[model samples]
Each structure stands twice: as structure tokens, then as C-alpha cells.
Target: MPSLTLADLDQRPELAPAVLALFAAAPPGAHHLVCGLPAAMGQEPTAEILARTSGMLLALSGRQVAGAIGICPYSEDQVTLWGPATAQAAVAEFLFTSTREALHLSRFGSMRALIDTRNREQRAFYRAHGFAAWKDNHLYECVLETRTSTGTVSRGSLAFKVRAATTRDHNAVISILTRAFPDSDHCLPSLAKREADGYRHYVLEEAGTVVAAAAVQDAGRRGWLKLIAVKPELRGRQLSRRLLEGVLASESRRGKRTMALEVLADNAPAIALYEHAGFRRKWTATIMTGPV
Candidate 1:
């Protein structure tokens, strides 16, 4: 390996091209907006943008960028990263840890990562570098053209009234999520945030009480399922599947070509339900936290 040097992106904006070249080789969904594309000789991302954004540092083999690491915001007080995948573990560790310290994450909060679950190499790198797998998220996409609508889908015995979540259902929805995903760092979107983010939610009411809820957001030509939860005590009613079907119907009717959602890979019941509903596995995301 060639001798490598690290530099703050804020100072050496000229290296953006080399860093982006490294990023382009990683799997899809590695970075966004900036896409970390190699900058034209005189066309680097402005210093103002780099300064206001999360801390980012680049790893260079001499003058050519080899690897880079930086924070990408995920939620309030939480962040993630966008960097090269082929770099050595030592280089990754130094850039990531240094960026974390530079941001004073301990005072603000640890930056988080939504890593691809199937990429075992990435997972191992995260583990070796002190990142804990906070959540195991599996991505699934529903092909709208081939699925049954809510009107045609039938349910037996486990009957529940499915309807759009109302403002009054906010408290009940939050309670269900707290019980369903205890201690998990998943992005439990608040009802206010939901509306602000253009998310629509549906709730499953068993005898007029909210037992399960799920939300999906408008993602241009595609639909993005944001959150779903069922009460802890009610386990085998298949309520989640039911609500998902209902949401899918609405999503399809709105002319969405497809819908996507993420669930914990270990949650076999949810996995089975999604699979049965024709939501095939698209990818798996491993939620990783900042270096310790």
C-alpha cells in the first residue's frame, strides 16, 4: 500500500474528485446529493458547504484520494457516514474516529450509520472499528402492479377496522412503537414530523382502540414506508401484515410504482409477512453507531 495522508475536507476541497472516485466503487446507496463524485480540477464542493455540514476528513495516498469518512445527518442529534468501502481498516478507523472527535460527538450525540446488511465486509469493518449494530434493518419493495388491493384482500377471524391515522391517534401510536421497539434507535417519527415530512399513516383498531400502526411517505415516484409497530401483547393476529396491505393499497392507488420499507432482519414474523405479501428483499441495512 502506498503511504497515505489525512486532511480535513474543509481545507483541501481540491481532493473531492479522488474521494468521489473511491466512493463510486462502493455498492449502491453509499452516498447522496453530492454523490461524492470526483470534482473537476477547479470545481470542488464549496468550502462554505463543507464548513456548515458535518465533520469530514479525507484519506489520500500521496495526492490521490484513497478513502474518506464523514458524518451524514440521519435524525435530530443523530448522524451517519459516507465513505470508501475498499480502504484498509486502519485508514477507515483513523478518518472515522478523528471525524467523530472533531465533531465532539460525546457532547452532541454519536453519529449513526445505515450500513448495508448483506455486505459482510462492511459489517466486519464496522465491528472491528467499535461500531455497534444498533438495529438490523431489512429492505423490501412491493411491486404495485401484481399485488391485491385492500378491498380484495381478505382477513379471517382476526378482524380489525383499518383506517387512516387521525390526529387523535398520535398518543396511542407512540405508545405502540415504544412497546414494539423498546430500546431500539430506530427513527420513531413523531406525528408532527410525519405531517411535516409528508408522511401518511394508518392504524389498525381492534374494537375502536389502536393496536397497530404504520406510516409511509411520498418519495417522488416511489413510496417509502417510514415506521410500523404493533402492541406487545397482541402478537399472532397478523395485524402488521393487514396494516401493510392497507397501506400498500393506498400507495398503489396513488400511482406509486413501488413501495419500500425496512425491518429488523431477525424479526422472522415480520419478514415472513412481508415476503408473503410479495415484498421481496431489496437490501438489508445494519444500523451502526460512531466509534467508541
Candidate 2:
């Protein structure tokens, strides 16, 4: 008889393969398991770095992994869930029960998931589980596919050159981030663990001074674009378009079919730029909070 079970990923390292399979089976543009699993599948999950070292679990039908759930701390009282994928009712219920218990154990007051709106089944599942839309997250993809004749490269009215970043450029990248996003809402592994981080990093410099930067990390078959920021004073020069093109072109050449990133609901200008570049809306991930 196949009995439902729940276990931490560390307990069943072999389940990584099955877990990756579940992610691949989702909608074309669905965000794969963002934690535990490799940025790209077929590779091993980063055991030491997933889920902020808190609540992470795998659902099982006897010995076979059926699904998984992860809780990344968003604040002292809040957590961000990664999965609860396209799973069966009983499977999801078990995962949710395990998740809630894990949260209570960890003392977190609220929990939320950034769900993809395009995946109707998953969206319906979240709603059924009492998750609500506290806000909207726009996920866009395909940097190269969206290229227009208008030229994706930034001519750099200020005379800037784009190139791969090195350790020496780290502080500059941080400086630009501080100035451009004083209340930073986005987080990247590079910022958290650059030493072991695998994401390819790039930077745009004007007269030898780093002014803009972007990053791309492999997510199994696709690539995820991280933070792309420009100095406030240089925003009008289309530096963003150039930096994105430079990053996307590099990744596309590597044979990655698509690239993706997320922006908050109110960031219309950034969404417009991505749309102009040929990137389409893959889905909207809702960050549901409180009891659900």
C-alpha cells in the first residue's frame, strides 16, 4: 500500500530527480522549484543553501516523492513558500498541513507564495487552500526572442562599455544597488552567497565607472534574470535595454531557450520595456499572506 509521507529533502537526496521531473511537467513558463533543486535540472540540489535553513519538505507516496514545499523567511513573522506544485488534493493537503506545522514550529506569523497565474490548476489549488492575492508579481521571459529592430544594445549616450563583472566590481555593483534601490525588494543568491554562486554576472560602465549591472542564473533548461539596475541619473539613456540585451544575448548563445524575471505589480515602465523587447507575460505570481 502507498502511504503518504513527508520528509525533509536531506532525508531523501535521491528524490531530487523526481522533484525536478515534477517541475518540468508544469506549464511551459511556470517557475521551477526555486529552492533546493538545481537552477537547472539533472544537476544536484544545493543542499546547504536552500530555504534559508528553515522549513523544507518533500511529499511522498511510500518511498516515491510526489511533491515538495519550502518556506524562505521573508521577515521575522513572515515566510515565502516555493512549491505546492501541480499535485493531487490529498498530496497538496498533506504538504500544506506540514507547511503550517513547520511555520508554527519556526514561530513565523504569516506565510505567502508567489503563485503563477497562468497555471490555472495551481492557482485554483492555492485558492482552495485559502491563499489570496495580496499583490501581483509580473513574470516576463525571452530577452533575445523579444529583440526589436530598434536595437537592443544601449548606445550609451554617456559613452559606456558593457562587460562581464569580476570580484573587483562587486563593491561597485553593491553601490549601484544601494543608490538605485534604497529599499531593495528583490534578493539574489549572488548577493547572499557570491563565493559559491553560479550565476553569470555582467556590468555596464561609463568612463571606467560601473553604472549599471545585471545577472542571469541557469534554472534547469531556462535562465532566470536577477537584478538589473541603472544609476538614477542614467535611466533615460536606455542603459537598461543595453544591459539586458548584453546579458540575454550571452545566455541565448549558450542555447538557453528562454529567460525570466519578476517585477512588482506597480512597475509599469519596466514591464513595458520587457514587452517592447519581445518578452511576453508568462504569468503573475501572487504573494498570499496571513493564515493562508
Candidate 3:
């Protein structure tokens, strides 16, 4: 097999499909974030977009590909790998070799990949490649098989009203998030696209202002809690928990059986809230960072 080249991704508009297939073939819950743009955007990724977005994906004669990295905004220091796969040893050799070559010239400081929690082989592969486990950054999952008996009534001392967010709620949500997670940049695009895709948002209103908010994206039998943020001044009031419960309750009622979310390992408060609310650790993914 020839060395993987940037020209391959440019030629394959079905790159997203191929990657998705790889994920499915691996095991359940193998990756937290998809490597490609959301299908809802109808964005056919271009070579320029790939190179600009993170690093370029290299491919070899349609049999092998590698050296793909996705820069995540949640963790600016890390990159996610989406490498080549083939049954041919030559193909694997080409992919590994190209990956090493790309690493030498890559601008990123760190790179990592999420292997399935149950797939020991894949996890070992990652370890052999020099990636270590980031024990603190664990993924959580909650099954909605049965709705929690918890009522939708707001539980906090803060006087707030829960309502569906409207067009008027965007700026307020953005402001709240900016204040809550000063370093995070993952949600903006997804939030913007929610408006375009017609996803419903839940907001907590206090004194006629949206203080806490969360967005829900329909994912078949599962519902994704995309963004959950609260104002800084209201930190210890449990407003975020109330808002999350309200959203989860509504999603459960709508036949969404699972709620999934990702949080930084160091965010103790947020992780505590999720645990208290019945979310359990499912897996962990590392964010590797180097230079650019």
C-alpha cells in the first residue's frame, strides 16, 4: 500500500459515511464525538475545510487511510484521531507510517482516540501507540428505560420558571455559557445549528431573564443534552440540577430512553450533579495536546 495522502479525503465525499461505518463496526459507544460535520448541516466537507478544521486526512488507493485528527473546542489542547483501516498488513503499515510522518509535521500539541469501553483490543492498540488513560475525563450515560419518579416541579430555592426557549433566548444562553465555561468553544456551532434544525431548547427564567438553559437534540430512542449552562452568580443554588431534571423528565416522557453527556474530568461540581441524578460512568476518553 502507498502512503496515505491528503488527496484521498478530497476525492471521497462519502468520508463521513465511511467513518460512521468504522465506528459501527468497532463496538457500541466507541466514540463520543463524531469526526465529521453533522448530517443535518448538509455540508459536503472539502479538502480546504478538512485542512482548515484540524489536520488533513490521508488515504491510500481506497484501501487504507490515516493521519486524520479532529480538533475539539471543548478541549483546545487535544485532537481526536480517525485513522485508516484495511485487512492488508501493507495497508496497516502504510497508515501507521503515514501517521508518524504527519505527527512530525502536525501543528497539534496532543492527539487521542476513544476506544469502546468493552473493546479491550482497541484500547490496547491505543496504549501501545503511547496514549495514556485520562482517568478524570470519563464519559457518562443514563438509561431512560423507566422514567424517574421525580416530578417536573422545580426543586431549588431560586425562583425560576422553565419554558421552551424562543428566538429571543439565543443571546442570553450564549452569555450564560460564556460566563460559566470561559474556556469552552464546543457548543456554539451546535447551538446555532439547533435553530436551523428546529431543535427545542429549555430555559430557566428568573426575574424575566434566562439564567440557566439546556438544549435537547432528538437522537432516535436517545436524547442528547447538548448544552447546559447557568449564570455564575447562581452557582451553588442547584439551578443547573433543576434545569437538567426538567429537561430529562420531558425527554423521558417523549420516549427518549437514554441521556448522554461529556464533562471535563476536573469539573467536580458538574460531575457530582450528574452522579447524584443517576448518571453512571460508562467510559473515558483522553484529550491529547501538543503544539497547534
Candidate 4:
């Protein structure tokens, strides 16, 4: 085997293309995994998204980029690992160990990696490194069709409207998201920053009050449904379906060709709702976490 060398991508900016190719050339059961970002099959990470990472560690073997890893800080206490993307299995551990050493991993409380369920080798590798399988997440997507109209729906004398949220709706949307995902870093104080990053929030309003909400991250022809929630008091009312319909309608109007999202494998209600809406599970991943 050739001797491997590691370099910080920022310092060796010229190696960017090879690092990207390492990710693009990923094969089944060894795909490059990025967290806190939307990446569908055939989708390549954009420069803007790469720029969000705190570090990119590249492994080289005689001028060839053999492996790479991108570190994205998710919060003060957690960071998401993008990859130990390597040309051969022999380099996976070297890439991961070098990354931990290069980035001084101890500052974070934990690290996470989301790997395709089929990647049994990678799963076992992480386990050997002290990571535990947290849960399975299913990635679902549906082709979208243009719609001419959408309006309030009525069910048993109750009517609700679904539409893109306005500035005035920010508080309500954030409140619902905060309540729904209390531990999430995507809500509250970060909402404005996220909106600036092209996330759009939609709401289902009943009598002028936002009853259900969803946040979408638009990527040209596709939208990633990041989070969706209904006000707790109205869960039995099927408001989630209504809000989802509205979101689809809105996305269609914006020229989106598809919508994708990830849901917990155990979330039966959410799975059924997406399935009923024509979304099909494309893949499953195990979210593994380990102390840093």
C-alpha cells in the first residue's frame, strides 16, 4: 500500500477538485455521507455548502486524493461527520483518526455519522470506534406536479387555510417548531438565519391562527422538508395532511419538481402520511453517535 499523507483543505486549497471527486465517485454501500445538508442520489455538494464546514481533512497517496472528511458543527456540543470517504477500505481508519487529531475533537460533547443501512462494514467500523446505533431514518421523496389552485379545506364543519408564512407568522411558526423539536438547533434564535439561507416556512391557519407549520429548504428543483409540526391541541384533526398539501402546492407554484424528507423509522403516522402523498422511501440510514 502507498504511504498516506493528510492536509487541511483550507491550507491546501488547490486539492479541492480531488476532494470533491472522492465524494462524487462514491459507490453503493460506501457513499459519502453529509449531515445537516440535503443530498439526494446524484446530487453533488455545492461550494457554498462546503464552505459551511469548519474543516475538510484530505488524505493523499502520491498526489492522489485517497480520502476526505468534512466536519460540520451542529451546535456548541455536537458536530456531524460528513465522511471518511476513501478510495479503499484500508484508509478508513487512518482518515477518521487523522480527522480527530487534526480537529481536536475533545471540545465537542459528541459526534454523529449517518450511514446507509446497507453499509454494514461502515456500521461495524463505527461501532468499533465506540459509536452506538441511535436510530434508523428513512429518506423519502416524491415527484411533484404543477397545480393550478389550492385553498382552504373543510372537514366536519372546520375549515383551514394553508399558505406561505409571512413575517407576521414567524413567532407562531417558531413556537410550534420549538415545542415540537425542543432539542433541535434549527428553531428559535436560528430561524432568521435559516430563512436567510433560503428556508421557507408554511403554515395551516384556522381562524387566522397558525395551527400547523412546516419548514422547507429549497434547492432549485427540489425541496427538502426539514421539519413539520401541528399545534399539540389539534393533533387528531389531520392538520398535518392539510399543511403538507399546502406546502406541496406552494412548492409546485415555485417550480419545484420534487420534494424529499427524512423521517424516523418508528414514526408510523408520518410515514403513512408521506406514503399517502405518493412519497417513496429511497433509502434508510442508521444515525450513530459517539463521545468525542
TM-score of 4: 0.91
Per-structure clash totals for the candidates: 4, 6, 10, 0
Cα misplacement distance, residue 183 of candidate 2 (Å): 4.7
Where does candidate 2 have its weakest 10-residue lDDT segment?
Answer: 35-44
* The best candidate in terms of TM-score: 4
Error of 4 at 97 (Å): 0.7
Candidate 4 residue-wise lDDT, 106-150, digit = tens: 677788888888877778888998999999989898888855448
Number of the predicted model whose lDDT against the real structure is largest: 4
Question: What's the lDDT for all of these models?
Answer: 0.65, 0.65, 0.58, 0.79
What ranges in model 1 sit over 4 Å off? 1-22, 28-67, 74-78, 85-94, 105-124, 132-136, 148-160, 184-189, 285-290
Off by over 4 Å in 3: 1-22, 28-79, 84-93, 96-112, 115-136, 148-159, 186-193, 197-200
What value does the lDDT take at residue 222 in candidate 2? 73
> For candidate 1, lDDT tens digit of each residue in 57-155?
787777766677755555556666655333577777767666666667454576566666546676676677678878766667777876556623335
The C-alpha RMSD in Å for every predicted model, in order, reads: 6.7, 5.1, 6.1, 2.2
Off by over 4 Å in 4: 27-36, 39-42, 103-106, 146-151, 155-157
